[model samples]
Each structure stands twice: as structure tokens, then as C-alpha cells.
Target chain A: MAQNPNRPISPHLQIYRWGPHMAVSIFHRATGFVMATAGMLTLLWWLASIAGGPESYATFQSYVVSGGEEATGMQVAINWFFRLLALGVTYSFFQHMFSGIRHLLMDLGAGYELKTVRTWSIAVYIAALTATALVAMLVAARFMGA
Target chain B: MGNGTKLGRVRGLGSAKHGGKHWLDQRLTAVGNLLLTTWLVLSLLWLPNFDYETVAAWLAQPSVAVPMILMLANIFWHVRLGLQVLIEDYVHDEGNKFATLTLLNFYVIGGAAFGIFMVAKHAFTGAPA
Candidate 1:
């Protein structure tokens, strides 16, 4: 099918080096998709809990808390699985939050200058990482204390 | 303070109008997420030992059932609003933007309905253990 000429042309991802705005935008979608899937996973877990008996429930819980288990069922440690999932989710959450704040600033019509945009973009990255670390540490502390 | 300055001076209301409303809604929904998530976390913590029957009984109560239903609806609605803005920004085609928003609205509403239907069925069915 012929591409519609009426569409405004914009550079695709492959055409240019990735930059902060691109990162922010892509990460927003990435996190959005991740959380959406996570939401579904959560709902499934709830449904399974409602449907299953003790043994099945234990199996499900095992899937959730497999972090410290030896075998962790099927060669992968549940802890590791959770860690990776948490990292992605946490990263996405923070990145989205950072980008969101940036968007909010834009809505207020602040940070319009090039210098301001660049500074905010850097701040977004820094804040996202910091938030990610904070989340990870909290999760670690909670699980460790338990 | 020229006349242009005077008109500009008179226009200095508290907010730009409508912007604060959107901002307030976003914040309220976020606060809802925080509270609902706390409940979910606490419930999940308590849920490890629960059997199917026990869990069902817990969910059957209005306390658990209603909050959950509300949370589910609000979460999806908030997501719809967020994605609506994203699509509006990125999807340049006017027709495409409209279609996406319409599709997103249906998705959110349909998901809420389906979720409520399932929760109600489980809540009222009184399935035998």
C-alpha cells in the first residue's frame, strides 16, 4: 500500500541517534506497555487465587516469592525473576514519572528554552535513576527484613 | 503599564482555566492509586495461606469487593486519559487520533465492565468449596 502523502513526515527512530526527548517518549510507551501487561498479570494472579486450592495457591505464591529459593521451579530462581521484573517495572515507573513532570512543566508553558529543555532532560534521567535505586533498596530491605 | 499591559494585568487570574482541573484530576487519581495499592499490598501479604474458599469469602464482602471494583475502574480510566494524551501528541493524523481515542475509550470502558462482571459473578455465586 502506498504511504499516505497527507501524513506529516517525521524522522523514525532508526534514522537518528537516540536523544533525551526520544528516550523520554520511548520510555513512556515502554513503561506504559510494561505496566499494562503487569496489570493483566496481577489480575490473573487474583483470578488464580480465587480459583485454586491450597496446593495451587502455594504454587502461585512460590512463583511470586521464588527470590530466595534454591531451585525456584524450572531452573530459574524466583528471586531473580522478580528482581528483573521489578527493575524493569521500577525503571519504567520512574522514567514515566520524570517524563510526566517534564510534560506537566510544558503544559504550564515553562521550560520552553533550549537550555531549559536540555537541563530538564538531564534532570529526568538523573531523577529516574535515583528513584529506581530508592525503589530497589526499599524492595530489598522489605524482603530481607522478612 | 500600557493599555496592552493593563489588559494583560487584568488577565492575571489564578490559573489559565481548565488546566488546574486536569491537574487536579491527575493528582486525585494518583492518590487513589496510592491508597488502593496500599490495600492491595496488605491484602497480598495476608493472602499466602488462604485457600480458594477463604479467599472467595474475603472477596465476597462489600469491604473487599467494592474497593476493588472502584480501584479497577479508576485505574483503567486513568490509563485511558494518559494514553489519550500520548496518542494525541504522537499520532499526527487527525483521523488516526480520533480513532485511537475512540478505541481507547471503548477499551477502558469494556475492561471495566468485564472486570466488574467477573467480580460480581465471583462475589455472588457462592461456589461450593
Candidate 2:
């Protein structure tokens, strides 16, 4: 079939002006991928560690959390790295959750208007951070109080 | 165009008959993940501590174990569907798409099975009710 070479084609990622909705949409998938890989692997490790008994779980805790009292320099660095990774996963979890909620709302035929969607898209970012903060506070209080 | 009815001419051209099913399953698992993940964060939060004993005892209960297993399965399924769509969109070559997709399924299934098995073991042998 013959086609016009000069025809204006669809604008792509670089061609369009970036917007909150576009950013959020991409983040949703990126965050989802992160969770499905790193997050889920960590979870499986946690579960398998528990099943392996206290000693095994203690190994996990030492590596992932405490770095052990007699920590080698390498152990300290690795443990901190895992801690940062965990934090990243936590943030991604919340981010994915709120973005997912936004999607669910749209699925129900709500918030389709340009203004409403833009407002809610931005709200997803804030809500995810707020929820993550709440969890951090609650966990901190629990650990500190005891 | 081929001496057939309109329906015949358009048969198997769009949707491929399976696309709708995949779309619906993705949304369904999304809802499942929303509930399961919420329950998990809240449950973990409500627990007294995050130590090995505390966490292990928590998962040992049938109530917790059942839901956790379901959550892991649901999440794996959801991820498989999501990644399949992602691969479909980005992996243009037929051979590459098939290879990646096969690996994706293998990874998801292996992870899900291990997770569920670990949870079940904890539930059965870890702590007394």
C-alpha cells in the first residue's frame, strides 16, 4: 500500500510535553517492576528464612538489619545497602498501591475529566509518600517504645 | 473481500479472542493485590515486634498462613500478567518475545511455589496454636 512519507505521525515520549499523568503512569509500571523483582525476592527470602528456623532468620536479620555487633566493614556496608534497598521497596510499594487505586477509580468510570484526573494523579504521589511516612512513624514508635 | 460474510472476513483479526480475557484478569488481580497487600501491612504493623520469633509465630497461625499464601499466589499471577503485557509491548521480535515470556513464567512460578511452600511449612510446624 502507498503511504505519504510527510504525513504527521503520532507524537511519542520525547515529542510530547511531560505531564504529571504521564510521569505517574510510567512510575506505576516501573515501581511495579521493582516490587515484582527486588521486593518479591526479599519477601521470599524472609519467608524461607523463617521456615529455616531461628538461626537462619537471625542470619537474615544480621545481614539485612543489625549488621551484627562484631560487624566487619564489608558487612556494615552490605547491611546498609540492603536497608536502603528495603526502603526503596517500601516507597515503591506505596507508590504502586496509590497509583493502582487511581487506576481502579478510573476503571469504575470516575475521574475521567482532564482536571479531575490531573488532580488525582498528583494526589497519588502525595498519598503514597504520606502513607509511607505514617508507616515509618508507626514502626519507629513501636521499636522505640519497647 | 474473500467471498465471505463480514464476520468471517474480520474473524481472528482483532482482539485475537484472548486479549479481553487477559485484560480482565489483570484488573481482577489488581483488586486482589490491593486488598491482600493492605491486610499484610496492617497485620505486620499490628504485631508487637519484628524479630524472628515474633514474625515466625505470626505466620504460624492458620489464619495468617492462608491469607499469606493467597496473597503470594495472587501477586505472582498479577506480576506475570503485567510483565507479559510489558514484554508484548517492548519485545518486538517474535523469538525474543517468546523467550522472555517463557522465562518470565518460569521465574514467577518458581518464586510463588517456594514462597507458598515456606509459608505452609511455618504454618504446620513452627508454633503451637
Candidate 3:
């Protein structure tokens, strides 16, 4: 187990053809990181606004949610950026959740077979996509006052 | 002086007995996050609105506030553990890796504390009128 500098490095992205399970595994880590950053920032801003009371909350809403009726062009651009970020975060949340479930099941000594692993991997993706779409639609409906 | 027994060398220099703890903690937080995040999504979806007032009102409820605090703590802990592994793997320079890990711990701890404090404030003081 001592260091062996002459030993060849293990096969990885360069040597292997990626498959569903590999993709899902990569995405699980990637999305987890993304959601963590986004969640931290949003939560901090939200908490600050709430602690500061209604006036501060209103100010935060104008910036983060509504963008106000008399929005400047720059403000509009920023609002669009936040909107896209919000959607991305929503997708990440679901993707990470499903992938986490897959990992939990694997940890429980299940889904070791190739077919079962692949099936679960694909299932995670599908669940994330479907849930993200539904949540996006609900958000849109809420915004449109439907 | 290279005279140590093989077992001594292996135990002293080889396996860092702490890895299993890190792995175990990561999985424990992962399970916590799975449940809490699901609850969060469902709660948000059930909300009447996403405006500041509506969200503030929701957080003011003791039921919501308690879980929200727990979720925030679990999330930050998990984030730190995951990011630590990522940094250790990719960051080659020992100095940089140490710096990055230290900064990461401070960031996650500080952010979690701020979040929980806010939740507690709202929970205790009630929603703004």
C-alpha cells in the first residue's frame, strides 16, 4: 500500500466510454455543488430581508422577484439573470434529490447489477426532469395569476 | 529510522483512520438532506404565493421554522463535506488546498449560523405586519 510512483493511473474519463450511470454520478456531484451555492446565497438574502422587516422585505422582493413596474434596462437584465438562475437551481434541487436517493439505495447493498444500476440512473434523470417541469409550470402560473 | 514494523508503518503512514468517519457523515447528511429538501419543495409548492410577505408568514409558523433551521444546518454540513472531497481531489498544491478547505469551513459555518439566526428571529418575533 506504500506509494508506487511507477504504477499506472486508473482508467477514468480519458479511458472509458461514459454511460448513463457515469453521467448520473457526475451530475449528482455537479448539481449538488450548484444547489449548495445558490441555496446559500438566496437563503442569506432572504433571511436578511426578513429580519429587517416589511420595508426591507419589500425592497428585496422588488429586486429578487418583481423587479418593479418602473424597472430600468439594467434592472431588467439583472432580473432576467435571477429568473434563469432560479430555474437552474430548481432543476438542480430535484436532480440532486433523485441522485441522492439512488446513492442511498446503493449504499443499502442494492442496485449493484449493471442493468439495475443503469435503470436507476435513468430513473433519476426522468424523475428530476418531470418534477422540474411541473414546478416550472406552477411558478409560471403563479406569476401569470392563473 | 525505517526499522519500524510493517504494521506500524501501515498504520502510521498509510490509512488515515478518519476517512470512514467522513464517508459515514456524508451519507448521513445526504439522507437528512433528501428528506428535508423534499419537504421544502412540497411546502413551497403548496404556498399561496412566493412574495416576501407570504414566505415570511410561512416561516413564522413554528412548524415551518423548526424544519427550515434543521434543513439549513444539514445542507451546509453536507456542502462542506462534499466540497472538501472535491478540493482535496482537484487541488494539487498543498498550500492552496489547506487555504481552500479552511475558507470553505468558515463560509459554510457562518452561512448556516446566519440562516438559523434569521429563522429563529422570525419564529420568535412573529411575522411582520
Candidate 4:
């Protein structure tokens, strides 16, 4: 139905003046996509590895958990990278989840004020980082037998 | 100042397609993911180790397995919805978008079915002695 579908979308990233709200908007989709692809793949792989029993799970642990001592050069680096990516995926979960909460409130006809909007957009960063940190702490505590 | 009738001016003006069902599904799934992913994180945190035996035993619990299945299903559904919006907005070419969206449908369904089957497998079969 378009004689001309030349409607302009939003400005490109370089030209657009950025804000936390804008970042939140972008991160919401970015995080969702990350979780959908990499996070989901890893989760499925993790499950399947475990289901294959300790033999396969040991390989997962060595690569995913410990950058094993025997690993050299690129091997250790790749292992560590996947380990870092796991944390990144965790952060993505919180970032997307908190931003979703903010959007949910907006859906319910609340937090529409300009000031409130800005506050929450920034708060999502702080909250997500804090939650990820807490998860790290809990995991550390468990490993330490505390 | 150019309108024969109010309806005339507004004839084809909207998304011109399905209204807000996509929007509503996104929000509803968001709420479900919020609850279920939280449960997943907590359950994972409670486990002592990530070893096959320990984690597998944990998942083998009926209490854990049921929510795990639900959580996996809900998360996949939410992801699928989000990806649909994303692919629609960004991928403009009709053929390419159609192919991408079709791949997405299969990916999400296969992922969810596989995950659900895995959970059921774990539920029925405990880790080795």
C-alpha cells in the first residue's frame, strides 16, 4: 500500500543525543537478543552436557568453569572468554528484566513523568549491576562453604 | 482542512494490521519471565556445585523439575516474542524477513521442546550412583 515507503525512522546512533532512557531502550532489545541467541544456546548446551553424564560435564566444567592448567595460548583465552560471556549473559538478564519492569509500570499508567522516567532509566543500570554482583557473591559464598 | 468525512481521512492510517495482540503478548510474557527467571536464579544459587551429579540430582527433584520446565517454557516464549518484534522492525526485505522469521519460529519451538524434554528426562532419571 505504499507509493512511497520512505518514512524516516529514528536518527542514527552517531547523530542522536543519548540519554539513560535511550540507552535503556537500546539495551532492552540488545539484551533480549543476546539472551535469545547466546544465552539460550549456552543454557541448552549446559543442560545437554549434564544429561550426557559426568564424562561430558567434565569437559564443560574444564572449559566453562576452569581455564584448566593444561590449557595453553588460545585455549585458556577462549575458555576465559566464554566464562566472561556467561557473566555478561547474567548481566543481560538483569538489565532486560529491570527494564521490562520499568516498561510494565508504564503500561499500568504509572511513572510517566519526565523526571520519573529519567530516574528509572538510570536506576535500571544500578539495579542490574547490583543484582549481578549479589549473584556473584552468593556463588562465591557457596564455593567457600559459607 | 481537507476531509469529506472523518472516516475518509482515517481510512488506512494505523499499523493497518493486527492491533495490539503482539504488544499484549510481550507484556504478559514479560511478567511470566520475571517470576520464572527469578525462581531459576534462586534455584541455581542454592545448589552447592555445578557438577553433573549435584546439579542433576537437584533438577531430579519433582519440586525443582516442575518449575524448571515451566520456567524454560516461559522464557523461550518470551524470547520468541521479543525476537519477532526485533526481526520485524529491523529486517525490511520481505523475503529475507520471512525466511528469518520462519527460522525464528522453528528455533524457539525446537529449543523449548528440547528443553522441556530434557527437564522431563531429568525428572524421571536421577543421576548415576
Candidate 5:
């Protein structure tokens, strides 16, 4: 096949007006990519740590859940950084999942109308936020002995 | 000269015949992921403790291990399908696209295999002491 160097390109970000659906669609892809990469890696590390016996598992746990009681200021800062990353991944998990459900519904011949699309896009965000908050609260309660 | 019209030629060339299967598999795995991930999140939240021993014991149950293995498979399959679309869309060079996709397949398969093995070990032998 001959390449068409002068072929017209489809309208993209610069040419198109931004909207809720567009943002949601882009977020779907972005979150999918991040989860597939970083999320999967974290999962693998966790599983491997479990399989590696207590010493290795403890090392992983220290990095993931605690900063080590004797750690210096810099180590504490780094521990908080990892905690933030874990939180972000957790949020992304919920967001990506809700968006995935939205896409599946659209594939099943629903949510095509413009109003419905807009409504569902916002709804997905709201649902993800709610789920993330619930998860965070539950985790906090568990950790705090409540 | 051929008898077919230009429009017919265009239509014939555009139908790759395999696109539908790819699209269908992606959606199917998405559905699976939706269900499986929900179970995962809820189960994790329900666990009394988050320490390594507790979590490992939780995963060691037959009930937990089986579903977890299923979830791992579904997750990796979905990741592969999604990443394949991404590679096809953005990677312009034919060789680069092929190489990237091949590597992606390896990554997903290897990761899934390792995950399943770990889960199965725990299920069979109980969690390491």
C-alpha cells in the first residue's frame, strides 16, 4: 500500500471543543494505561513478596505500610510519598472501573444520546469518588482500631 | 480492467474481517473485570487486618484463591487487549508496533502466570511461616 503523506487528519484536541464525554473518554484511556503499568507492577510485587517468605514480605510491608520506627526525616518523607502514590492508585482503580462500566454500557447499545452521555460521564466520576471515599474510610477505621 | 466500482473496492479493502472478534473480546473482558474487581475491593475491605500474615491467610482460602486466580487472568487479558489497541493507534512504525505488541504479550502472560502461581502456592501449602 502506498502511503499518503498529504492525507487529511481527523480533528483532535486542538481542533475539537472540550466536553465532559471527551474528558471521560480520555481519562478512560489514561487510567487504563496507568493501571496496566503501575498498578499491575504493584500487584506483582505484593504477590511476589508474599511468596518470598516473611523476611521479604516484611521488607515490602515496611515500604508499603510503614516507614520503620527508627527512620530519619527523609525516610519519613519518602514513606509519605509512597503512601500518596498508593492512594492515587486506589483512586485510579475506582475511576477506571466506573469508566469501563460506562463504556460497556455504550457498547451494549445504550447511552448514545448526547444528554445521556453527558449525564453518565458525570455520574461515573461521582460514583468513583464515592467508592474511593468509602474505601479510604474503611481502611482508616480498620487501621485506627475503630 | 476490473468490473468492480471504486466504492466496492474501498469497501472490500476496509473490511479486515477480524476486527469484530477483537472488539468483542475487549468488551467481554471488561465485563469480567468489572465483576471481579468489585469482589476484590469488597473482600479487601472486609478483611480484619491488612498485615502480611492476615492478608496471606485470607488469600489462602480455596474460596478466595479461586476467584483471585480468575481475576488475575481477566485483568491481564483486559490489560493486553487495551494496550494492543493503544499500540495500534499511536505507534506509527510497523516494526515498532509489532515489537511493542509482542513484548506486551510477554509481559501480560508472564505477570499473570507469576500471579497465579503465587496464589496457587498459598492455596495449596498455606501461607509461608
Candidate 6:
């Protein structure tokens, strides 16, 4: 194998300017990573709540406990912010899950044809959007009393 | 059947390889996690407050506790799978890659299980009525 000084490198995602679907896919992976980070954070919350006794438990709830020493009005507002954050994270988690299952299926030798792959990708995208919107509406309704 | 195939002289090439098995395990766990996460979201929605007794009671019941255990196990397994793929792609040094992957797999599983066990023990035994 003769070594060429000017060997052609394969084009990666960055080689070409990003398009809509490519950007969406990148965000999809990013959100999945974010969800994983959130999972670890939740594990921390669980451990602290379970380990630090009732005082720690109270501290965990302090975020949502309005007009209290542990939670001031501003803190309550922050907690509500987290509630909205939770809703977004929830939607991302599910949408990622749904799309991941499709990828898993493709990895298993299914959906290899270009037509089939594109069709499923579109389906997954649509499902993700619909699911995210539906979940956000449901969660927002809880706060709005609708 | 090809003469130039590398398998002819490979003395230790046996049925010990389990790549497909690992792939299947990862896929199955991924599916389990998806199902459990749905339930988890609904449970979180139903949670009225974050009091100790409430969380403890919810966790102590077998209905919820069992799913929680399964979810923990599967999530760690999926994490291991994702990390393994990442390490395989990025880590070029063979010996170091093997060591790091092995350590990472063990750490993820061990830490996750330990965290779950600690929480379960607290929920089952420590909370007051």
C-alpha cells in the first residue's frame, strides 16, 4: 500500500454546511446527552433525599414549598421554572426514546433501503414533535388549571 | 470457503465471541427503559408533594419498587452500551481501551446498583408512618 501525501479524507457532518434535518439530528443527540446528565442529577437528588434524613428530605421539597424559609417567593418562582424545565426534559426524553428505538431497529438490519430509512426517519420526527407538543400541553394545563 | 481468508490460521477462533448477544441485550434493555420511563413520568406527574413519607411509601410498594429496580438496571446497562461504543470509536490504544472500558462498565453497574439499594433500603425501613 503506497502512502499518498494527499490522501482524500471522507466528508464528515461538518464538511458540508448543515441542513435542517442534520441540525435536528444533532440537537436530538445533544438533548439525549442532556437527558443523561439530568438522570445523574436525579440520582443525586434521590441519594440526598434518602440519606440526609428528614431534614434533607425537607430541603429537597424546599424548592417547591412556597413562602417558607427554605424557599422564598423567588425560590418558588425558580421551582416553577424547574417545573417547566421538567416538562421540556420529559418531552425530550420520550422523543429521544422513540427515535432511538427506530435507530435500534435499523441497527438490527431493518430499514436499510433508502426509501424505507427516509420514511421511518420522517415518521420518527413527526412522532417526536407530536408527542412533545401533547406532553407540554398536558403538563402546562396542570399549572393553568385547565 | 475462500483460501485467502484470515480465519484459516487463527488457532483460537472459536464460538466464544458474543458480540451479537451483547447487541441484543442492549436492545432489549433499551426497550425496557422506554416502557419504564413512560410509567416513571406518569408517577412523577401524580406526585402531590415531595415529602419523605410520600416518596417512601411510593417506593416501598412492590408495584413501584420493582419497576424502579428494573429501570435502574436497564439505564445503567444502556449507559454502559453507549459508553462502550464511544470508547471503541475514540480510544485507539488497545490495552488502555480495554482497561478503561472494563472499568467504566463495572463502575456504572456497581454505582447504579449501590444507589438503588441505598434508596430502597431507606424507603423500606427508615420512613415513619
| Comparing 2 and 6 on lDDT, the stronger one | 2
Candidate 3 positional error at B109, Å: 0.5
Residues A1-146, candidate 5, lDDT per residue (tens digit)?
Answer: 33466866567678878888998988888888988998888888887787676777787777766767787787777767767877778888888988988888888899799999999999989998898888778776778455
Give the CAPRI class of candidate 5. Answer: medium
- Model with the higher lDDT, candidate 3 or 6: 3
Q: By lDDT, is 4 or 6 better?
A: 4
- Each prediction's number of clashing residue pairs: 2, 0, 0, 0, 0, 0
Query: How many steric overlaps does candidate 2 have?
Result: 0
* lDDT by residue for model 4 (B3-104), tens: 665457776676666648878888888888888888888888777677677887887788888887887888888888889888988887888889999999
Candidate whose TM-score is highest = 5
How does each model score on lDDT?
Answer: 0.68, 0.88, 0.84, 0.83, 0.84, 0.69
Q: Write the per-residue lDDT of candidate 1 for residues A27-123, one digit (tens) a residue.
A: 7777876765575455656555564544665666566545234653553566467658768877876776668768767877898888888788888
Please report how far candidate 4 places residue A144 from its true position, in Å.
Answer: 8.0
Give the number of the best model, judged by DockQ. Answer: 5
Candidate 5 global lDDT: 0.84
B1-129 in candidate 3: lDDT tens per residue?
A: 264654555664667779999999999999898888789878988898776678888889888999999999999999999999889877757788889999999989999999999889888885765
The residue-by-residue lDDT of candidate 2 on A51-132, one tens digit each, is 9988999888888877667999988998889877877888899999899889988988999889998999999999988988
Runs in model 2 deviating more than 4 A are A1-12, A144-146, B1-12
Q: Please tell me the TM-score of chain A for candidate 6.
A: 0.65
User: Which residue pairs in candidate 1 have backbone atoms (N, alpha carbon, C) closer than 3 angstroms, thus clashing?
Assistant: A66-A79, A67-A79
What C-alpha lDDT, on a 0 to 100 scale, does residue A74 get in candidate 1? 57
Which 10 residues in a row give candidate 1 chain A its minimum summed lDDT? A67-76
Model 6: interface root-mean-square deviation in Å: 4.5
Instruction: Give the clashing pairs for model 2.
Output: none
- Order of models, best lDDT first: 2, 3, 5, 4, 6, 1
Candidate 1 residue lDDT tens string, B26-88: 756756765775586567556544445667777777788788788787778667767766786
Expressed as tens digits, the lDDT of each residue in B1-129 for candidate 2 is 354554578776676678788889999999999899999988988888888778888899888999999999999999999998889777767788899999999999999999999999888888744
lDDT string, candidate 6, B1-129, tens digits: 444434555545666678888778877887888899889878967877555767777776778877877787777877777667767766657787989888877767776777678667765776556
